[model samples]
Every structure is written in structure tokens, then in C-alpha cells.
Target: MIKVMDRLLLFVYSLAVGAASVFAIVMAAGGFDADWLKNAVDDIIGEDALVQTLVIAIGVVLLLLSLRIFIVSFKRSGGQAPSINQRTEHGDIRISVDTVENLALKAASRTRGVKDLKARVRAADSGLQIMIRAFVDGDTPIPALSEEMQKTVSELVQETTGIPVSEVSVYIANVTQAPTTYKSRVE
Candidate 1:
């Protein structure tokens, strides 16, 4: 609702400003009789109470719209990448979450039975919560594979980035099916 109002207000404001600019330009170029236009405007305002109120209201709305635009123009997204902020005696360090996810994927892929792996990292209250969803190859026990993945991801992320990982969750999504290639003797 508010967005619609903002767009509508902007459209109306732009139209009014454009029309006023064109009118002024024409008058200054002597394409219009400036005195007659001025008198017409004066008469419209002077002869009607409703017209005077409407003009004042429009002026107030335009002033408000100008201020709104001016204030919003200064706001910025800062164009900064999302990263984990760290401070030490030397300086500040930032490690992007994407790097962490990549690290997790790399670590999980090292497990023998893990395939089609996807990793997600979320900032937790204490540290980071990592989730790994993988398709298993059925070459190893699920419990052992899950354990190894969790440990590897947690340890690698923590060691490489110096960030504590609060938890690592692994979900074995499915088992992989290998395609068989069979060739028959020539007839």
C-alpha cells in the first residue's frame, strides 16, 4: 500500500514539475502571452476559495515530496560484501561466508562415500552452524561417513578461518546409483 502511494506521488510530482517547466520555457520564449497567463492564474486563485486551498495543499505536497526525495537520495547500500568481521591486535580481518561454505564443501567431498554435497553456513550465537546435505555412494557406513564429514568440515573451517564452529549437521539425502556398461560379444 505504501509503495503504491509513493510511486503515485512521484508520478504526479514529476508531471506537475515537467508541465510547469514547459510552461515557463514557452512564456520566456514569447510563445505564450506571459501577462495573460499570469492574470488567468491570479483570477483562478483570487476568485475561488477552493482553488486557493487546493493550490496551497499542492504546494505543501510538492514541498514534502521534494524533501522525501532529497532525504532518500543520501541513503546507500555501501556496496560491501557479506563477511564475518574479526578484530585483533594487528588489525581487522573479514572472511566471507561464501569462502566458509566452499571450505565445508571441500572438506565434505574428501569423505569417501559422500557425493552431490551441498553446504550451508549460518551465523550462530556462539559461532557458526554448518549444514551439509549429500548423496551417499553406499561404499561406507552412513554413520561413519556422517561423523567424518562433520568432523572434517568443523575442523577445517575452524582451523583455516580461526572461527569456532558451534555445530555441523549432515543429512544423507539419497544413495547414488551407478550406471552399468555391458558389451555383448559380436554376433
Candidate 2:
């Protein structure tokens, strides 16, 4: 729904810009003899093609800046990578919530002592939020396990997806399976 709205807005905005640019070009062409227009613009700005080029350049720069901000804001503190925002404008491309969640899950699974990982992501007012569940071995220390898991998973996801992980819930579902003894194996 949000994505649709953004597209609609962007389309409308582009249409408006195009209309305005055409009007400006026509006016400039007609008023080439006007002293004010001539003084305000040079050959670069006076030419219709040049005006169009400048508009495009400005649009590209603004789009890139918006993307940069989105990436920076979506990331967790501590120098983590930016989180991709659902409404983030990146060179006309948008990142979905599902993609961010999937990346988080994959990153969590890569951490040591992490057996299984499940991540859920939802859109927030300003950005996106995440919930993480990690299944770890029973022998792993609670404090150390939580800390390391948080760091590894958070870093990986943030770096990969550029979305800040708002909340990470670590649930140690069960301990790792014990190795089979020789006698047990024989039996």
C-alpha cells in the first residue's frame, strides 16, 4: 500500500515537473529578447535542452541524497550498516519489508552458537522494526550468548540490508544435542 502511494506520488511529481519544464522552455524561447531572462540565464540555462539537462541532474542528485539518508537512518547505532527503508527512494528502486526480514534471518543463522534463527519485520512510522528469535545451545552462557548473537546478527543484517534492527529477542529454545557415547552407539 505504501509502495503504491509512493509510486503514485512520484508519478504525479514527475508529471508536474515535466509540465513545468515545458512551460519554462516555451517561455524562455519566446522571451529570449527580454533583458531579465537573458541576465538571469546564459546559453547553458537559456537553451531548452540545457534546462532539461539541469533538471535531470538535480533530480538525480536529490534522489541519491534521499537514498543516503534513508540508509543512514535505518541502521542501528554503533556504526552498523544502514537499513533499507520501505519508502526509501534509491535511484527509483524501493526495498520491501520482506527482503529486510529475510536478510536478518540469514545473517542470524550465520552466527556462531546460533542453531536456528527466525526474524520478523514490520513497517514502522519512521522506518522499519525487527524481532529476532535465535535457538542456541544450552551450554552457551546466557550473557555472552545474547551479546555475541546480538552483535553478529545485528551487524550482518544491518550491513547487508541497511535496515536498523529495532528490537532483537533472543530465545534459547534448547541446548545442542549431546554427542553419542561409544556404548550408546554400540547399543
Candidate 3:
């Protein structure tokens, strides 16, 4: 999944940055006096021209790899809120995707069996599609609840925004028991 890949890339970038920061800090704190590092530096400085060239190439490759990873990790357009454009007689009307999502959430919340609802709205060929993920009560009937949520969301979106809903897909992610309060024995 793209989300998983993005997270993985971000983790790698973080690690690279952390390592570089620690290395720089140690060098600034006079870690260059360490015998191993001193010897390694001396060897590098004393190497033949061909060997120095190869070392420089290897360093360049690593730098380029880190830079590529850093850029990819930070450049993400998916996190930005999207908008839907509609043409009208007077002008163009643009509606925020968040508005559609909020509309769908409100409609779904009105359904009796739905809880912990989240909605994502996207532009579709016909109009818009509403994808909802929700938690339902354990006793709730899935088919009936899904149908109710679909109808409610479709109708509400159309009525409120005049946006035709191509489809309302309800994914029941979880079923949870009602919350109960417990009394402490000491109290």
C-alpha cells in the first residue's frame, strides 16, 4: 500500500538524519582524536589518487541515496485536502472535499446503529463517491445498518450540496460493546 511505503521511507530518512546528526555532534565534541577514526582519516588522506577517487565516488553515491530518500519522504500531495469543481450558469463552484466528508459523517451519525464513523469523499465520473468506515454496536444488524447509512448519506449529500452521490460504500470495521462504568472497591 502507498501509505505503508510512505511510512517505511519516512522511517529510513529519520534514521539517516539521526545518524548524520550524531556523527556531526561527536566530531564537534573532539571525537576525531579517537585512534580508529584518526587512523581511518590518515589512511584516506594518504591513499593513492585512484583509491581516493573510488572513495569519493562511494561517498557521493551514499549522499545521493540519502538525498533521494529525504526528498521522497517529505514530498506528499495526498495529505492535502482536495476540492470538487462544478460549472454553473454564473460561474464555477468549487467545494472542499472536507465539506462532503463532513456531510457524509453527519448523515451516517444520524443512523441508529452507526458509531465511530469516518468518511472519505472523492470525485467520480457521475458525481461523488462516499466511502465510510464505521464501528457498529454488537447487536446491530449489518445489512440493515449499511443500507440505512447509504440512504442517509446519499440523500443528505444531495439535499445539502446538490452533489449527486454515485455510490455510498459502508465498511463496518469494528463492532463494539456499550461502555460500562465500574465502581472501585476502595471507594
Candidate 4:
């Protein structure tokens, strides 16, 4: 949810900056007189207490927005890689999440009945949970296939990356049809 809000802020900031840039460019191109803008702002400020208050409020809001964007720019304190970190006596190791997902897919695809496979991995409370969505051959029973796939994926990912896999959820999405081979007879 926080990430979503940050993205929203970024989008709004981008639009705001673009609009300001265009406005400045137009002003520079003599689309409007600088004196006209100064007079308009001066008139608004001199008009009434309410107008002056509104101008101050708008300035404050924009200032706060800019400050927030500046801070969010540095939210990630360091250049952090997208990976899982492991600490050992020698040093530290980082494994890419993509690597783990690929490992899961590789393991699941090796199962006899699976024709096509894709995998997703997410962090769980104790370990990682892998979800495999597969298209399978119609010959095998889904229950046995799913069981085997789950075991295979979990074992392979853990063994390879040393990342504990808590569960592997297999979704047998569809049964794939085999391609037919054409045969010709000579006359």
C-alpha cells in the first residue's frame, strides 16, 4: 500500500514538473508578458486577506510536495540489488529472486506429465512459497502430478539456493493437446 502511494506521488510529481516546464517555455517564448504574471499575482495578493491566505496555502502545499518527492528520491538509502541475502562465515551471498523462480520452473518442468510450466516465488513467514501454474499432458492424474511437482520444486530450489521453501502450490491450469504427425502413402 505504501509503495502504491509512492508510485502515485511519483506520477503526480512528473505531471506537475512537465506542466511547469511547458509553462516556463511558453513564458520564455513571449507567449505572455512577464509583467502580466507579476501584476496578476500582485493583484491577487493585494485583493483581500482570503486571497493572500489562499496564495500562501498553495505555496505551502507545493513546497511540501516537492520536499516529499525529494525525500522519496532517497528512500532506498543504498543501491540495493533485487535479491535475497544470505550470510555465511566467509562473507555474504545474494541470490536473485528470478533465479529461484527459474529453479522452481526447471524442477517442475522435469516432471514427466508436465508439458509447460511457469513459477512464482514469494516470501513466506518462515520461508519462501512457490506457485507453479502448469499446462499438463492429459494422461496423468492431477493429484499425483501436483504432488510430485510440489516436492520436486521445493527440493530443487532449497538444494540449489539454500533458501528454505515452505510450500509449493501447483495449479493445473489446463491439459495441452499433442501435435499430430502427418503420414503420406506413395502411390
TM-score for each of the candidates:
0.66, 0.44, 0.56, 0.69
Best by lDDT: 1
Q: How close is candidate 4 to the true structure, as a TM-score?
A: 0.69
Q: Worst 10-residue stretch by lDDT in candidate 3?
A: 72-81
Alpha-carbon deviation at 93 in model 4, angstroms: 2.0
lDDT per residue for candidate 2 within 88-174, as digits (tens), equals: 555443466567777777766766677777777765664456677776766767678777766776677667766565566566666
Question: Could you tell me which 10 consecutive residues in candidate 1 have the lowest summed lDDT?
Answer: 69-78
lDDT ranking of the models: 1, 4, 3, 2
Off by over 4 Å in 3: 1-80, 181-187
> What RMSD, rounded to one decimal, does every model reach?
7.1, 17.2, 7.2, 4.8
Candidate of highest TM-score: 4
Residue 50 shift from truth in candidate 2, angstroms: 75
Candidate 3 local lDDT, 27-141, one digit each (tens): 8899777887878777778857776887798678667667766687578657655789889999998889999999999999999977699999989889898999999996878
Instruction: Give model 4 RMSD, 1 decimal.
Output: 4.8
Clashes of 4: 0
Residue-level lDDT tens digits of model 1 in 1-187: 7558767778888998999899888888999677898887996679788888888898898899988766656766366867888889999999988999999999999999787999889887799899999999898999999999999999999999999999999999999987788998998
Judge candidate 4 against the unseen true structure and give its global Cα lDDT, from 0 to 1: 0.86
